[model samples]
Target: MGPTGDGGGDGAGLVVIIVLAAAAVVSLLVAFGYYCYIRNKVSKHLNKLKRNNEALEKARSAVEEEEEGEVGPTVVTERGVQVFGFKQLHSATGGFAKANVVGNGSFGSVYRGVLPEGRKVAVKLMDRAGKQGDEEFKMEVELLTRLRCPHLLGLVGYCSDNGHRLLVYEYMANGGLQEHLYPDGGSCGGVSKLDWETRMRIALEAAKGLEYLHEHVNPPVIHRDFKSSNILLDRNFHAKVSDFGLAKLGSDKAGGHVSTRVLGTQGYVAPE
Candidate 1:
């Protein structure tokens, strides 16, 4: 040993080394904690992003469901359903002239019209004489939009523009069952094309249509205006239920049902 002071200096250096080592360990621990914090944040952000993407996908699917088939609120396009313009229907029905009138009913006169794509259609211009109100017209459109059945009349489209309420329907080549069953003025007296077998078939098909509304649809639909004139026929005499001016949505199943008013054909009315 050189000097006693050298021992003191060595002791001081050892203590400094120990302190430095402790500081380094603490720094490493702090770095690890910061890394863990950053990782946790990134994981949370990813989870949130995943949830957002799932929500977006679900929304897209719901939109696709509503837009399924030919359903939209605009005309102009050749589709299974539409919301037509007043001008378009006016032109199609020859300005609602007398010549285009095919049949007259409690709602209004039915007119034959040809769409731009050469598609034959029947346009029923709701009578402005207060027989049909806005609520009834809107309800009919809403129900037809949701209701789709083979035996039930298909609502091709409608027009609620320019203070006018008109419904567009698929042109039934055979016309109304009434027209074929009981012809007026000319083809009177005898049995028309509707034979006994055909009449039975028509009756079955019509019942099926009504059954669909009663059992299939939720809350059920009441065709308050069920009648022979409301039954239309295809080219093959296949009957489909048409017209829903006085249709009503039923209440709870347990409570049965109540009619707000009696508005159907007097003779055809179901005697309560």
Candidate 2:
């Protein structure tokens, strides 16, 4: 009887130990599952935040691009002249560096620049304190926008921003006739001297340009500052009349002359 009782006690102890070990294992598995759930939740949250940040950045870039496209004011006229943004011109001329300077006049300086489309252009940067006033600037823009002739310089665009006035024109490779006629230690010195035939051709082209302005246009234009320096030549030696800041509008009637202030070069002015 004693042996049987002892055997029963031992069996009970073994059963208890086995149950406790099984409980410990079950607890460990539950803890591991909970940890995995929490880790997965945190990973999903981080991925959502990353996607939202990328979306926000894309939206900001779109707004910036829209603003860049709308830099200058809109023009209602259908003329060929474009209204350029100040920033675009600034970048084109390399911040208006001195090395890009092609010529200088009493009004301002001209710079050689390349447009974004790889087109070369001449940018005339008007001096704020120079002889040209706002009125003259407006007059030149108005006339150049309307006048279109083979022998006349073409107006590409203009910019009026932050009290800065600039005119954009087609690049004249050969420069002005004055440089060829009289070598004055200028950038156009490397150009060969003009022969008699070339000089006559230039004169004829200049005459044709003046005739178109005086006769063809309804309100005839009088280029008050016509001189050799104002006549630009292309690479092919084709002459084009430029610099219409002092241009005047004459009457359409016959024998009508528009009288204005006496403003022209000393030697080029006609005797009254």
Candidate 3:
């Protein structure tokens, strides 16, 4: 009877140990599942944060590019004129399509374009084999950078990359004064005859532009190529002097004049 009682007790003890082991395995499995669920949740949250950060960075870059009108990094001339990339200007001008051309000159052609910031602009693309060489291009950039007046055409930027030279200006919706004075084969057409009052206003504005360049600014500028075509008008018929490719920097010395070979439009050249 004693041995039987001992055996029964041992059997009961073995059953309790087996049950406890099984319960521990189940508890471990539950804990592991809960850990896996938490890990997956944390991973998803991290991925979402990463995506949001990437999107924000892209937005910031676009804003910067539009504001600066530069690629890779900001490049400004000595006079605070922005420098643009060749690709940027090319894209803006729609690959310099014939349909986008607004004007053609001895040096190159001008195209109307919309910038990335949605601002209308005029791009003057210099011809590779034009008479205007690198010196003229550089002179225009330098002179335009220093000359800033309401009556003068505003220089938006310039591009000089891989032998591609171009100048960017604020778009003049009314086109050039030549178009209004002589409408045949001009850029802006659907316009009626200019009234006496309107003509006088345009003349006065043009005079103001010249006065600003000749008197107001120190070391006056000489618009060597002043002509009807060089005088651009805005949407409100406000005259703004354009085209400084042949501009010469005047001397500040009393009675001093820049002596150079005469170069201007045939009919517009001054007989000095």
Candidate 4:
């Protein structure tokens, strides 16, 4: 009887031990599942945050590019814009005084002025009541800023303030070709005779300048008022096409834009 009781007690103790071991394994599995769930949640959140950051960076870059392309002042800053101050123009043109007057036109007067750095320039004062007015001013400013040919006059600066408008350009020492072709005030003898070579050179240069204006820039530029008087001569007798108030730019196709008002001087106008 004693042996039977001892065997039964040992069996009961073995059963209890097996039950406790099973419970321990169950607890470990539950803890591992909870840890895995927490880790997965953290990983997903980090990935989402990273993607949002990339999108934000891209938006910022695009805005910067637009700003740089749009409102930038200098041509270098923006790709095509040129910005000049009113003060610089005033100082360069001798405050638009009468003593600096060099020539006059239907819409404006030209003045010869010297800059602080000893650079000589010609300033054209635009009349506020002119027919083209703001449109001509805008065209001249836009076209001159992009034009960089050796045969084209360089635009220095301009001023618009208190009903005053002006355009500044490089000074031409010999004046316009018209002066040499037809002298004013009965000074036919005052005009210089053109040799064959000089005449040919002038024609060739004029053609080349027009060709560049028609073919070079992104949008072709046409000098609607091209004539002998509009052609200026420098000290070295080099011809420079000037006065872009009547210029136009656009398509290569004809009939794209037709001017409402007649352009160019008499006898030089192209038949439309």
Residue 108 of model 1 has an lDDT of 73
Tens digits of lDDT, candidate 4, 37-82? 9999999999999999999997787566544443212334442433
Candidate 1 wrongly placed segments (more than 4 Å)? 1-80, 130-132, 185-188
Q: Candidates sorted by TM-score, descending order? A: 2, 3, 1, 4
lDDT of the structure predicted as candidate 4: 0.77
Which of 1 and 4 is ahead in lDDT?
1
The estimated TM-scores of all candidates read 0.67, 0.70, 0.70, 0.63
List, residue by residue over 129-231, the lDDT tens digit for candidate 2: 6455787789889999989899999988998877889999999999999888778666555664888899999999999999999889989999999998999
lDDT for each residue of candidate 3 in 62-110, tens digit (9 for 90 to 100): 7777565465324574667667777788788898889999999888899
lDDT at position 151, candidate 3: 90
* Per-residue lDDT value at 230 in model 3: 89
Per-residue alpha-carbon lDDT of model 1 for 180-227, expressed as tens digits?
877763445556767899999999999999999988888888898888
* Candidate 4 clash pair list: none
lDDT of 4 at 58: 75
Q: Evaluated with lDDT, which candidate comes out highest? A: 2
lDDT preference between candidates 1 and 3, better one: 3
| Model 4 error, position 251 (Å) | 0.9
Among all windows of 10 consecutive residues in model 4, the one with the lowest summed lDDT is 70-79
lDDT of 2: 0.87
lDDT, candidates in the order shown: 0.83, 0.87, 0.85, 0.77
